[model samples]
Target: MRVMHVLKTVSKAAPTSLHRSASKTSTRGRKSPVQRATAGAITITHADRVVYPGESITKGDVAAYYQRVMTSLLPNVVKRPLSVIRCPEGARNTCFFQKHPMGGLHHVGTIELKEEKGSLATYMYAKNASSILELVQFGAMEFHVWSTRIDRLETTDRVVFDLDPSPRVTWERIVAAARLLKVQLDELELTSFVRTSGGKGLHVVLPVNPACSWDLVKDFSHAIATRMATGQPQEFVDTASKTKRAGKIYVDYLRNTRGATSIANYSLRTRKNAPVATPLRWEELSKIEGGDAFTIRSLPRRLSRLRKDPWENIDSVKQTLSAAMKKLEVGA
Candidate 1:
């Protein structure tokens, strides 16, 4: 009877061992191509250390970096699908990704190409490295890359509001600018999003319908800037000179270039590893300290309390650039 019991126990153990082996095999096979590539080639010595070389980076390295960083920095944003574009040859690399999380250090998704004409090293060194380091050490990694071919996306029209206050510009002036833009957009029935530039200004963005052309988008932006300037000439600076810009707000429409890309909303910037541009409600602008209150370090926690997403109804609001321009021409 004892011998019979031992045999039964051995038989049960064999099935369990077989099951475990099969499970492991299945997991190994299910990993995406990018995951497999990352596992085989990339090595992380410290969380915040990143090496940007003069040589070309392989697709595998890019994939691995994206996977690792996005997993942490972009956990919430990744619920949506993503695409990766290769950095073109001769493009200036004005940014670096941090390897570790530290002072406001967080994972970043996009990199700035800088001035369309600079050496890779020149571009890399141009950004605020201290800020970038902070983000890598402390922020999440949900990073992505874009190539010149990114225009292929259905959405070609981009509306950027370049914002900056005059030297010695008070915080109240900045808040007033935001409120004016918000009210104007609301009047037009167009949806818009707001973010601090991580500097002296605030950027107000509007997503255009994929059908719009670049020219139409530029014209619409010009109209808005002109209108804002006319409404508040004293507070809104539209002059081209730095000296004249004192006590005024500049409504920049130049960010609509073919190769231009705005820092991703909520993306952590390499400069000072400051948190990427943050989405803000109009009301918060009045309460928060303009320069000191926002940074790459504090954005994650601030995002947790937001009940409504600024771009939640983006699909419904997408409109043709021509249509938008026509409306703006009529001062709609």
Candidate 2:
């Protein structure tokens, strides 16, 4: 977690030129991959390295999966810095979190930032497919990206309502809770997209116009989450206390703030099932039974028919938190 803090601090202190640098560079800088090369390509050693046992999945296969879904998932990951869960051995063995800039990966960009405490550190951010492949070469199995890009560090592009349930809760109850929260958000005139959390929950993501600061968005998120818990006492909660959950779902709104990450859509998990974080239509929520319904093995086939990613048009729509804040302030 200390290293992750270094990157988080660096993310905030990133120079304004970093934004322009992020833009002027090629979105798909084409070149071959090298282990320590400066750019263009990457090499995946331990191609057969297994992360999930009994599944026959390999590090190389996972890289290929990311390549396959790059067109669908790149928009969400390309510009953002990742907090990686790397398992140099394998998923079942000891794994650690990474936020510090790696030294020997091609196309992987770094920003050396000064901390408020008066110290300097470097952080890493990805700009293209090769950047991801480079990380994979290091045995990264789970990738958690921040809410905004390195260029617009303070402005969140999306507000996330990460929904979690107690062990006693069922899918129907989860669906009921998600719909209830969406109705409230709808009244605020916000359009939200949903994703299977790739774990034990659902995440309602709202792409917004990036005008508000992290503080403003965090306050709004906190207020709305609290309202859902207090307003619908029987259906939802906002506390971290499990005993107080009372079988209600948690409307986790903290993902709206800075230095926090939500698993990227189409990303994979290290869990036994190799479950995937998947985007979905608003109408598909009720039909989902479990997060593992879509696993790594089944995803390749699913991709063949998905002409467009459910989130492909997300960046095209820009929303602001001002009105949503106003509506929440009025107790609407």
Candidate 3:
């Protein structure tokens, strides 16, 4: 469809109140006739690519999807620097797009140029390509949005150890790893927040001072993972190889990069379009079914009444890397 038509469609879809929380915004750019034809209900902003099973989304469609998500799933993360990328037409191996680090792939360490740009629309697509690729590998087929703002940096001094069990792994094992993580973090007096990955695993996020570099964070994560593996050999897998991780948990420390972004708490999953990663009270861990936490489709509604965000006061909490590391050594 044409891009201009898509712009008009998105304008109609724009939320009446730009001030309304999560409401849509105005479309204030000139467009070509091509943009007018294939407009959709949503507009894609800061996206690298849009993947369709048998067709490609026109520029208009891209813009529409951007607006849709901004109006729908992205208000919280939107405050961060933003970009978008669209997937090409007739693409089959979504996994191939995801694993590749070049172009729009999302494996990690992919870069896109925004300042040296052509059209603003084109730049948005280029910047978000890599992130879109990663989300697609996780069963996402739509436009993937991204933010590059350094201000999004929340924890710098704190260390996070992500415990992810392989698919088909038992929930009991996942919980056991979580229990152990709580003990470990508590002993160090490093407050932590635990949330489901929206898939099979759990992410235990800790807020820390931002003084340390990524290398230190990596070291701390590795040390904790090693300790946890030694203490619970059967339940936690410490190997760096995929083949050796069978019947065990994997400790993922890659989320410590400077621009790294996790799917936000209470964010939506575009594939199932369901709510995923709902925040939980630590007490609810044992009560709810393993996968009952939340998904994309249900999160916005839930956030209306949520009084506290898990990471709300993360910045104010004072804890040093030295103290945290020492606590780890004593298993305090």
Candidate 4:
């Protein structure tokens, strides 16, 4: 049997941890180009099943798409506990969130979580192309990963500015607000990465050193957000109330919590057009009219024509909140 019962041994003294094997053919050191492209490790049970009835995209197609993009997508997810949204029948069928045990799946990475309820739960991780493809076989339609890695649960490596616009806000205004946030981040000398939220907004992320707790990060994020909102009241808000969000975008900094997860880069989203969460250059942000501008149908071509990954240096860059916090003159 290919399915492995991924057991996470946890205790009061130990934080949640998993014994991960990236693939069935696990070996020490780095994986090669050839290893990443192999889909042979994963078995797709419903190869011909149409998962996207309107677009006629089959289960096999989704699996293959994941395989092709797996190499580019792994860094953002590897070692990070994930929240998977599965549509077992199709996009048209009832779907639910899968967060624990991973049921019985092939080559899926596992991690234990310190739940708020004072217990441990086994969550899934994607360690290799085989594992990513395995989830596709299990009907995973969307993947969301914690910003913090499993090895360092208390420390977060990135901060996200989720610019959630109100229903009444125009797309143009949303773009403008995103540009505003980017410029402010730039002024602080922190490199910012902007991406479509795969919904009606944009997310601006900055890679930071994981030397602080979730509470401190959350506080720093709030300071930055409130400062921006205070300065540009017409353009933004710091809360989620629809009434307060009138004609403004809400800067959601709450995703910095201990267990909150965001959609992984290059992951598919729940939408009629099947839009993929895309990384963007600051210049590209101005031209985008909607979040769905780049869908699964178009991203492969975009990746092929690109000279290099826009977020290529993200993981390598070492940044800290101290400078940005000082620049904003805000305290944690």
Candidate 5:
């Protein structure tokens, strides 16, 4: 919708309280509109239903959060193929992960994607406010995006290094691992950004030239992970083997592969308190306590107070894997 609408809602916002307006009162023999909240053209049904029971956060509250963050969220997700987690009843209830459209929602549009089996599949994407709100209406809790935009499906424009920490690993070590990766990336003359995965890890992302193939991108990422694990065997592991992950951080490079996805920035996680996958400045990492430190209830305040976006320069950054690739190949 309008930018003003987004600004107004966020400026005068809080987690939706439990009170209902008089207009929302039900009439005899008539369906009540209390359960739905409408913006300009989009409507979120079950607005009063509790999605996060622990926080008493309602569907409307989630919708409001999306609206408030849409300016920031849309850039990372719009026009990208998505795999969403839908919690139909609520976050505490049954949830299913979906990549292709199953024929219910109209606002969330679908694109034909070529699958590995040489078959065309319909993948979902949201271009604007209505489509995003439609997903909130569809009970979508988390949004994951592929590395490439739909326009350039085979050409990846981004690289993501997911630092998946073992349960025994402390948050401090996780932070340290990200900084170390940053140092390595810096040495290669590549600029990178960082964000919380909203789970147990951090994602170091870099915007790359879209000319690179998925194979090249994935190989480069694997090289970085391998080099890190080799240099610091005591703190890092490169493989996905669960048994080897104990007391270390797993540098998950697989998300750079074709069709792989990472949680989009500003997206909510399907967790208690509705934690957000938040982006932070490198300096802010040491100050932040955990990956799930910022929830839907607290993120708006943080956003309002921030002087500049942590990833403000991400879109302007232009780099390729060319130089980095040669270094890894020689090192190998």
Candidate 6:
């Protein structure tokens, strides 16, 4: 099961330095410009409201981060069904995950999807930059997207392995697990990309042709994860059971299933300091210290400094899993 972290209520007495700085810059008579800030066509309200009180990151700051990362962020989320972590009051207060559309947020679009049991369900999706900012305005802090797009709801486009590690696992071991998966994927002729989960793990993504059924994709991912866990019993576990997960990395292939969503790259995590689910070049893995290595404050700077996007060709690489799935099934 996935754990949701709510921002604990911060005491009024302990204010962050960033908050203090904002207070010092306030004009005596006029409203602060930050009270309402624009992103694309949407004006974010309560812009000065601190969402991440520990870091004094306000709703406006979150909007700004989205504005800055929209180019890289949009591709992963646009037109895909979404589930968001909403912290309306702030990161240090109450929050909830919203999968369906809430009333009065017409700016955010919704698509009606048929559920497994035959009932119709409406899920929200971002149409563009403004739609995303509108969601931020609606209190969404983290954006999670489905593997399939709205246009092709039945066919998935990617295989995601969320490498969740037990507390006892070291960073080195986690890196090894990722590289090991890469090698295995290469052997099966599947190209994979790596990213931080923005929490405690890495997401190894395989961009595949949207021709496979969800069951086929899920089973294929499970097979790969199972193969690794069984081959390296001491280092990995394929199951999500916490009892079997101690001191080992859990190859969570569950993200590949229908209705399942993974954190969109560049999305802010609900954790303190607003860590970002950042994409990394395979070679950059050794340099990262942890999953939360890139936070909102640091990500824009990192992007500005990078010569090229780490997952530059992700949208273009539509490799199918047919060959790899067959290879794995045959134990080749």
Q: TM-scores, in order shown?
A: 0.57, 0.84, 0.59, 0.84, 0.90, 0.90
lDDT score at residue 22, model 3, on the 0-100 scale: 36
Cα RMSD of all models vs. native, in order, equals: 17.6, 9.4, 10.9, 10.0, 7.2, 6.2
**TM-score for predicted model 4 compared with the true structure:** 0.84
Tens-digit lDDT track of model 2 for 1-332: 11221222233111111001121334587543222212125556656567676687766667767766666667778778677877777777667677776566657777664444767677677777777767877777778888888888767888888889888888887777778778877888888888888888888888888776888878888888899888878878888788888687888888876778889888888777788988987787766787656787777677777776777678887878887888787875
Q: What lDDT, from 0 to 1, does candidate 4 have?
A: 0.76
Candidate 6 structure lDDT: 0.85
User: Which wins on TM-score, candidate 1 or candidate 5?
Assistant: 5
Q: For residues 71-159, write the lDDT of model 6, one tens digit per residue.
A: 88887888999988988898677777778877667567788888778988888898887778788888999999999899999999999
Model 5 lDDT tens row, 214-291 = 999988999999999999999999999999988899999999988899999999998877899999999999899899
Off by over 4 Å in 6: 1-34
- lDDT (10s digit) by residue, model 1, range 197-249: 76667888777665665556666777888888887777775556787678788
Error of 5 at 124 (Å): 1.0
- As a whole number from 0 to 100, the lDDT of residue 209 in candidate 2 is 82
lDDT of 1 at 28: 55
Q: In model 5, which range of ten residues has the least summed lDDT?
A: 2-11
Kindly list the per-residue Cα lDDT of model 4 for residues 214-233, writing each as its tens digit: 88789878988898788889
lDDT of each candidate versus the true structure: 0.46, 0.73, 0.48, 0.76, 0.84, 0.85
TM-score of 3: 0.59
lDDT agreement of model 3 with the native: 0.48
Residue 249 lDDT in model 1? 84
Clashing residue pairs in candidate 5, if any? none
* Reference-based lDDT, residue 138, model 4: 73
Q: Count backbone overlaps in model 3.
A: 58
